[model samples]
Target: MKKYPFVYLACTAAVVGASLGATPASAGHMTHVVHAGQSIQKAVDAAESGDTVLITPGTYRESVTVTTPGLTLRGVGRGVVIEPAAAKAAGTCAAGGNGICVVGTKERKVEDVTLASLTVTGFTRSGVYATATDGLTVRHVTAVKNGVWGIAQEGSVRGVFRGNTARDNGDAGLFLANTISAEQGATDTGGTLVERNRLEGNRIGVTVRRLRNLTVTGNHLTGNCAGVFVVGDENKPRAGQVTVAENRIVRNNKSCPKTARLDALQGSGIVLTGTEDTLITQNVIRDNAGTSPLSGGIVLFKSFVGTASERNRISDNELSGNSPADLVDQETGKANTFEANTCQVSRPAGLC
Candidate 1:
């Protein structure tokens, strides 16, 4: 694991700034307008690279997929919605269908795709799911009330999911799973940023797994099972260099649920399980109470066999009034280090 010595905010902010500075392709590219009753899938299928599929205001009932590169699917205004195709209450796509699925693979990698200013809901699976796409951007969108995650990405690289609202999903609001099947080769996802978003009313707010060089900052998280989770122990071999900073994570009051996902940790601002090379700092973590004594502000726990959540740091945060304690640790997690954190109660209290 490469030690990310630079500040997370600076690095990601620079990248976001560079993206903002680049010229958008819509200026000279072809624009296809899809009316409310028209087929967005047809428009996307007909679109070429650097083309824009502009959706007008109204609710469309269908699942949209993007396979072309350098394409932008943007709503004209706030009222554009992609709801579950009412014909089949389960959705029109195959079982476990998402609202929008942007997919690619090593053989044919999609690049420079953007989805913006739209609302997607009522999918049986995630609202928006992207896999194996590079240079992906999801901004100013709303994903809500999906069967599972609001937005989910897997095996992706160099992505930005910012300025969005993700809430009321069955599972996590935003999920990043980076490990591909070993048969595909040992490629760990990298260079992703999740920032300036509102995540609430889900099982987990931001659920991260096995993504390297990720930065989560300037987000508001509340009313969820847990605010942020940096996971390891699935034994994929790489989950590192994650930074959670300058966010407000408070009052995530739900307990762990008994379901197919089998969530065992909840009611915490941040939970670190079998991770490494992470930094949590400059955030306000408080008022998260749950039924479990293990629920609290920051937890460093382990469940898997490798890496052991070591070389992680927590510093300069305001933590208080979480149920049980402000900081909790279990199962050989003393390898993590903390510095100058403002907390009154911590399990193994000497760390405070």
Candidate 2:
């Protein structure tokens, strides 16, 4: 929530910038190869901007931090693993208890850093944590058994997270936030995309908190305590302008104990709190049943901070077997619409 005074870009330019990551290996970009016994940090520290550090298939007992722009840290195959060292690892990445960290300051954002085809597990905190980055891409990585998020980003813009597997994390499988350190207005992401990922066995599959201008689409989420959560609070530039579409969220009935900030969670498909102008459409949500206040197929609950959910649209979703109701609107928010959704039950009746 610390103030992220991003220079707002034109709409067209923002859309273009959203797709600016994923730079292919060019003719001249250097590639540093690391063998089984070598250190990845040495290779990464030796790399310049726009360089590639290609790691071979091996278990690397270390944490990696990337600060250079346009750098690619890619593993050759799925056998490449990164975990904590025997002793305490060094640097801020290990201090943060993350397997990998892509860090940048607010004054200078890291641009176009990519992480692909690796497995980072058994960390005390997040498997992969990124902050203050632009055009970051994380694809085909497996993050499991972490203490917190599987993959997380904050104060970032134009990120692409696709084709990843995140399971059995202590918290959300995928988490994106405006800022976790302070209270401020939502930050525009310039259309970040979260697509086609497999998320299961976490507290929540995906959590988008106090962020705007992003799309969560075509993901498969199940076996978690909850599916997708779009969270907001009473702040300026309200968290909205998001599209949640074409995802399969089902049977997330794994019970999770209540945290300091939230109630105990179970069987929640998609929940939106204190958000405005968001679209929840075309999702297949089924068999999510529990007695929690937030449990439902698609729910609109009053925010704990007392902000009303306003001007949101829920349409064209297929829902069934959800206990209490498939569609629950527990708030008296204005301008909220529920139309064309195939569901049997609703809280105040007649919203099917």
What TM-score fits each model? 0.86, 0.92
The 0-to-1 C-alpha lDDT of every candidate, in the order given, reads: 0.79, 0.90
Best by lDDT: 2
Tens-digit lDDT track for model 2 on 1-352?
5522212111211111233222234455666666676788888887778777777778999999999999888886578999888898789998889999999999999999999989999999999999999999999999999999999999999999999999999999999999989998889999999999999999999999999999999999999999999999999989988999999998999999998889999999999998999999999999998989999999999887989999999999999998778999998899999999999999979999
Local distance difference test, candidate 1: 0.79
Local error of candidate 1 at residue 3 (angstroms): 55
* Candidate 2 wrongly placed segments (more than 4 Å): 1-26
Superposed by TM-score, candidate 1 places the C-alpha of residue 333 at a distance from the truth, in angstroms, of 3.7
* Candidate 2: clashing residue pairs, number: 2
